[model samples]
Target: MTTAIDDPRRTGYAAEVVANTLLDLARAEGRQLTQMQVHKLVFIAHGFTLALLGRPLMYNTVHAWKNGPVVRRLWQHWGERGTRPIDAPLPVSAGEPDVGSDAEAMEVIRSVWNAYGGMDGVELSRLTHTRGSPWSQVYGQSADLIPNEITREYYTGLARSA
Candidate 1:
């Protein structure tokens, strides 16, 4: 039985689907990304999706960690890679529904890649850590979750300004 979390129409694509798509884009450009870079890119793309399209990008939870916004599932899945560039795609686990079918989502990921793909993880982290950024607002506070509403509002402001 598929729940709302697993249904792309209800929530969003699986984080791995998003991550794998990002990795694929990087590979096509002859680039690579550390786990940190992957996480940040995913979060950034998600934020933009929420703001611009008024929809979520991934079902995964994003937490304001010390480094920056992090998708917890991605953190654990790619943690073993450390600072090394991830060279391969994430294999879809058994029983997991195949996704990445949303054209709008793919376009958003592609746009994010074209915009921020060149920067390394450190640079991306610095961008997300900037004052008034979604991560900056809730980080170090009693709460950890970087609410989607906050992300949408912040990114919406950014879009309007840009």
Candidate 2:
């Protein structure tokens, strides 16, 4: 069956653009990127997107979990210990923010990376699962089957791409 990972809008346009931006960012910072490196970069972008949207990390975590055991372990470990945002109010804005802009979204990605030491996908996923205390509150329940499907489709795509 097709999965969210198979959706071009999700895994192709949005995810790929973010991944490329991250790769460029890492290179600008003098970091070398491997295939897995690209994978991690994309993962971080996905996580940052969720955080900025005020959405739970469920989908992102599930995506990471499908990547590999390393990802799953990362989620399990970091999701348990991550820090959370304290209740606070945002200043009233005159209009809705442009959530679809890449430049704006990239800022959030950079912020998350800076706050977490620019960890790779595997490490970041692990950290998020373990150290992202706020995330845990939202990730109270696990969705086992969904993640498996996501992971399967992702790997299958990778294989086809290879």
State the C-alpha lDDT per candidate: 0.87, 0.41
Cand. 2 TM to true fold: 0.42
lDDT tens readout by residue for model 2, 72-149: 423332343323321222222243222235454656667655654355545654643543222332353464322433
lDDT by residue for model 1 (70-92), tens: 99888877776768888788876
Residue 45's lDDT within candidate 1 is: 96
All candidates: TM-score: 0.90, 0.42
Could you tell me how far off, in angstroms, the CA of residue 158 lies in candidate 1 after the best superposition? 1.1
| Cand. 1 TM to true fold | 0.90
Best by lDDT: 1
RMSD of 2: 15.8
What residue runs in model 1 are displaced by over 4 Å at the alpha carbon? 1-7, 95-99
**Model 2 Cα shift for residue 93 (angstroms):** 35
Worst 10 residues of 1 by lDDT: 92-101
> What's each prediction's clash count?
0, 14
Assess the local accuracy of residue 76 in candidate 1 as a C-alpha lDDT between 0 and 100. 78
